[model samples]
Target: MNQEDQELQTEKKGNKVLVVGASGLIGISAIEAFLDAGWIVVGASRRKPILLSGRTLEHIKVDLLNKEDVFKTFQKYKDITHVVYAALYEKPNDLVAGWSDEEQIKINDQMLRNVIEPLIAVGAPLKHVSILQGTKAYGVHLHPINIPARESDPRDNHPNFYFDQQDYISEAGIKHGFHWTVLRPQLVTGKIAGALNILPAIGVYAAIRKEKGESFSFPGGPSFVWELADADLVGQVLLWSATSPNAADEIFNVTNGDVFEWRSVWPALAKTLDVQTGVDHSFSMAAYIEENKDVWAKVVEKYGLLNHDLNAFIGQGHAHADFAFAYGAPQGPVAFVSTIKLRQAGFFKVIDTRDALTEALQSFIDRKLLPPSIA
Candidate 1:
């Protein structure tokens, strides 16, 4: 066999990576992406994930917040060749005030440090570290951020765990030989149960609202343009970031390389769900979903869905709702970031937001999580 074939065969038989935050939306998608590419993946999280496929994933329950738990976990995985740190800690209150919360910094910083310190302390065979970040790094939460936010733009003068975590990794690099890369993706859509993922969130939202005979309404205030990144695509980019030499010590903004206004996207979601969309309606999903938890339970039971807890399904993911349904003050908020750095770094993969959103919504239906939209 040729050299490329030999490498493929070798990976099929032996490549391994330990993905932290394995139960999360990004972590779960990253797991599938890596496994599809022939990697033997070990998934670490606070609780074991209910995986649709584990052909190559070894799930381990780990608490990154607890130092000893973090230490003991890595001690058992000395064979990990690459580390994808997708883990994050956001307290319940920080959801609304993360831009100014102090705990957001402390906890998230420690979580990142906990993972790398343990493995590095044991001198594991780690080669590259890939960290999953989001547009929050651009300070979009505080307000409507700069249009087409570039990688070289100045910090948003806000308090964020992304900075704390990034600084931790950078500091470690000064003393360690393992190179690292950072991937900042906009709203990532994917299927991960019990986690606050956008696609499933949308599926459940539409399914519940449609059944109630309420015409689909855009929840956020004024219309504003935004971006999206598919979970699977982000996973592939994470892998590329780890292996690509140009990615080291660099932060790349990732998206589907597309943009849309919520008003325009609303109709598409309505058509996909087979619901009749109506005028824009500004309301807090946090309040709406909470008040309608019993309504969601009926839909889940009626549809034989994976989750019965509306809070777990929607309440916990309020942050994602806040982002998606955002119609913040001083005019509607628009979060636009440039992916030129990622492209310039040699990774060409992209996902069109419309198709990405539809694909994820369809996946929700295929899995019986949502009843097919009315004809």
Candidate 2:
């Protein structure tokens, strides 16, 4: 067995964990990962996570944007030993592409303050705070990021809220005698109901295009290399970050440690959905997916899928597509982040990019969240 496998067997579990943002992609996956490892978990989100498995946790439906409500709600859970903060506040439908310097920084920073400030005030026995971040923290969203991006790279001279949250946690950790870990994962993928999974976004997009007798075409610009991180892999890493002796007070860049070009990824995605592959026809996928709303609904009904409505099945296909097809950079885009630091710190988990994507697609089909289509 691998060293990680052996370590997991002997590592600690049953610690009380508070996972905020428990309904989102990262949050839900982390909850299940912690549970599978035998942690007593309490999940807090705006609503209960849409469960696809038998496992459940104590869920608190308190909005992080509301400080008073957050304080009161967390006060009852005083025995919390660690926190995995995957909470995020984004624009309603266009989370990926939506960014405003002044407003976003202010609001997101406020939410972090709300969650931790209250916990500190209430004297919760929190030992660690692990915050979630992405390449946006490295300024990839605004421009081409550094090749083989490392954790020690200087913070992006951008107005991303990641810095705000990281800064807050850093100070709090010093003052409150706790350690903080920041995890920056690339393009997190998984099957999450009510959360946007890029694989299903690709599946539905191809399904719509194929239903029109059109081949599944690449809808964005020319191919660019991207690092894809599996949600479950990230969850496992989060657990490691919280419990590992060497993972304290560190920032790590995480990916599946593989690279893919859209040229191959698009075909792989089409094949997963069992759809016909098409040529690269560059256009605004966000707008294209928006136009196919009625058609996706028909696919849901035709296959007797779990969702009656397309929007209910896929949370933000347009945004996921828009963000995935990041093409506005002046130079060719390569947004791969180095996981060397994470590996050096003793977390050796790895995820196969194509396998992760296909499994997530198959899961949606088996659950009837998506229909089985033709390749």
Q: In terms of TM-score, which candidate is strongest?
A: 2
Compared with the true structure, all predictions reach lDDT values of: 0.76, 0.79
Residue pairs whose backbone atoms clash in candidate 2: 274-374, 274-375
lDDT of 1 by residue, 169-260 (tens): 88787678777888888877776655557556666667768778897777776666778888888888877776667998899999887787
Worst 10 residues of 2 by lDDT: 325-334
lDDT of 2 at 361: 86
TM-scores for every predicted model: 0.92, 0.92
List, in order, the clash count of every candidate structure: 0, 2
Once fitted onto the true fold, the runs of candidate 2 whose alpha carbons sit more than 4 angstroms away are 1-14, 93-97, 194-196, 327-332
Give the Å error, residue 10, model 2.
Answer: 8.5
Q: Any idea what lDDT model 1 has?
A: 0.76
* Each model's Cα RMSD: 2.3, 2.6
